[model samples]
Target: MQDEGISRARFLAAGLAGAAGALLPAGSAAAKERWGLSYRGVCYEVTDGETAETGWNATRMRTDIRAIKDRLHADSVSVFGDGAGRLKATATEAAERGLHVWLQPRLADRPPHEILDHLAETGRHAERLRRQGARVHLSVGCEFVLFVPGIVPGADAVERIRNLMSGNYDPQQMMRRLTAFIAQAAKVGRSVFHGPLTYGAAEGDEVDWRLFDLVSVNYYSYFQDPARHVRELRKYQRRHKPVVVSEFGSCTYKGAPQKGGMGWDVVDYDKPKPEIKGHLVRSERTQAAYLTGLLDVFEAMGLYAAMTYNFVTPDAPHRRDPRYDLDMAGYSIVKTIWGTENDPTSHWHWQPKEAFHALARHYARPHRRLDPA
Candidate 1:
């Protein structure tokens, strides 16, 4: 889901840290507390009303959450989407499996300049999850500069973002309005949800850090110099609250890193309906390499957490036909194959990609701070 970042005082108050030698590959001494994966279940907002044959089966959600913990070795999972039922199922499953959950309520398609209602709903969800004995952080929203209606000029989120990035709008004026909205939302969030709250902002978007508890940024900036990512993250680090790299991952295609956050949008995905037709070639190695580089940078920088763009994309599944392999444009670490029922080796209608293993290795390292018992 397009939710914001994460920060929790209780997580810090506990003096938590990854186990000794678990911070990073040998030679890195930084203590990172959260290593998370963005697990996107089937949500109507993401599918755009394509739920007839696509959705996350609750029966398999628990198993998937377990795999995210055992296979990915991640301590946290950010459950994205707007479906309250799905979010509860995902978060409850993740919590049962001992994974901290950052529940992000997506507000896509909703009018911008008006998020108080969304915030209220999120607060209710967060409160319910916390009362159920789950460690939860509510991400109010994400990248409003582009997704919100009034913030940018366009019919939809895609059109709005494209217009804003086209360099025609007055950025200073837009930022002022965006920050004002966020501040108001934060006030509303504080009323209902008595826990960590944050907003996910895209890189280059100006956010008033003083308004939120955590300095979160949806940084898909691998296209630029690695130093640039560090510089941007450091600006958040100066805020004293946890700095979360809320979203970052590459599509399963060559040169996807060059597109960064827009990897999914770079390819035209509408003509064939559910099936995407594009010129980009799939390359699991490229996806793995891009993710590994970001993991290294995040570990070395000693940030609070870095959640990979996503763990699964049920709507964008793999297909035998090259033309139907729309998953190449997706950020899921695993490619879901719809008709894998006959394959005993298939893990719940999905196949893990190379990036999955690479991330597993990176997260498998021994760290006392992140996994403190």
Candidate 2:
């Protein structure tokens, strides 16, 4: 029975693709490019103290935002936060510089009513921004797949899957909530978009294609090789959805040992104490290679938009905390606090690694095509 169901779903997807392809012209100009960078909007998780605080000083944060606007020639900026004031301020700043703003508030753990209340508040704020002649985009949550277990535990997996397929609670409920939210916001005159937690090109069971205008996918290359990564994105395009590489960056430092406690070194207490050096410096060339190759794939696939992982970090010193520190070891686009004077080739610095220059030039003059021959 499960095999038959799987085969039916594949047939439906293929039929949908054929119908849509027949309706559209071949190689029509792809969707407009809307590219930007992702980072802590207002809050940064401090490594030394293990506390979340505003990541950048007002002046530096504004400057950093402007730098991204200038460098990427982005059509818009996206920030993650739930506060109306913060979203309004970000929208104003980006609008002043002729950029749109997308907000992805954290709503995964909240109760359904609370989530609705938050979305109502966001809709109100987005409407206000629209009144002020600013473009604002709102997303319900980020990576809701990670929340499925919370909503539907392991014990209820079969029951939950049945309910989801029967249009009882999962996607059907999500669509109803989103439709109500969108209708209310539309009354106040605001345009909206949805950014779901997408893994590769495979749209999860929870995504209702009709709920969103633009399909947003976040890609992180922690476990997959480059070829597999590109193949995943190609599958996503086959669905006839305009795609966005919402988050992408590679870690070069693979937890090795270093001679001196220099640069951004954090001791992982949980690991075996055999001097685990980070992959930061060791991964610069690999990181650059990945970016170059990924960009080529994205362009060839005619992806709508792509945003790199981050822009800047807070002034806090790198310490024992794993999340930011582990990422700092190799994931940064600019060196800022993570790079050492000794390691001029560090992936974190302003000096463009091969990947940095490759992208900068690609975005600057995208008309030139590189022949595989």
Candidate 3:
């Protein structure tokens, strides 16, 4: 699932000073509303389809949504991908199931107009969902500099990333374009969407928080200095808006936690067929420990929400062949399996990985009040 960061209007009061005591853990019941998951059920136009996450089945989506609420016990979900209709359906389903909806419409590598048009449609639908008694927030977009155009070179995110690494592009100019685009997105989104608005930002996006209602960052921390994660988060603190970690997770391989967001770099795309570039040991426990440790960080930080990168990546099916298996590069908590008709009672084709069980246990724990004493 494609997930972004969360803002805590759902739980935040006037300011952090007033909000801090309530949000910090003292062991009552999770403050009861911070856990969330990313649903990558519909990334409309992924380049090369590196991820197999965009398998949209209503039954499966609903089941996954239910699991986020019922099984994983997530308080909310950030919906990613394109197609206004699909976004509406998935978000509505999640909302009706009583999970808060972070309605993020990811129209990747499209013209700016197309992207905005998608946001307009999704915003209207989100507004409708909110009016219909659902807790909904519209994330204008995610990673404009990477996904949207004119910031850097290249047609898709991959090319842009490569181009960015080459240092041929101008950073100041890129930020200028990105910052402006985000402002326009916020303005356009606000016209149709009459609720709290958030933008799913990269760690270094430098987004103007004033344009948004809350701060939502897709932060994947390399496990070098865990305390440094806390310091970086505090930088985003606004007087009232709650800061959230939108996306964070590791690939199911050893030492992935140290690489953070770059964990996916292990894949050898240059090969005729995709495979691990080198000998890498698969360790689900490494991913599990990394994820749980961050959850602890978020919990301790009293964040608005901490949404792991995703629930499942269906395109990247788990294979016994380590060289062929795509799940090793994914951040999904569940490993995708193939089988529908064979299983009479299930619409989903996934097995719980170590991270899933670990998260379930973490989420199921009692959270204390996030309200001031």
Q: Considering every candidate listed, which one attains the maximal TM-score?
A: 3
In model 3, the number of clashes is: 15
Candidate 2 lDDT by residue in tens digits, 248-351: 55443432112111223343446643233443334445554555545544554456556654443333223234343443454445544434422212233233
Per-candidate TM equals 0.79, 0.58, 0.83
- lDDT for every model? 0.66, 0.44, 0.71
What lDDT would candidate 3 get against the real structure? Answer: 0.71
Model with the higher TM-score, candidate 2 or 3: 3
lDDT accuracy of residue 354 in candidate 2: 46
TM-score computed on alpha carbons, candidate 3 = 0.83
Model 1: lDDT to the true structure? 0.66
Q: Lowest summed-lDDT stretch of 10 residues in model 2?
A: 40-49
- Runs of candidate 2 with Cα error greater than 4 angstroms are 1-57, 131-136, 147-149, 152-206, 221-230, 252-281, 315-330, 336-358, 366-373
Leading candidate by lDDT:
3
| Model 1 misplaced stretches (Cα beyond 4 Å) | 1-49, 112-114, 131-133, 223-225, 270-278, 340-348, 370-373
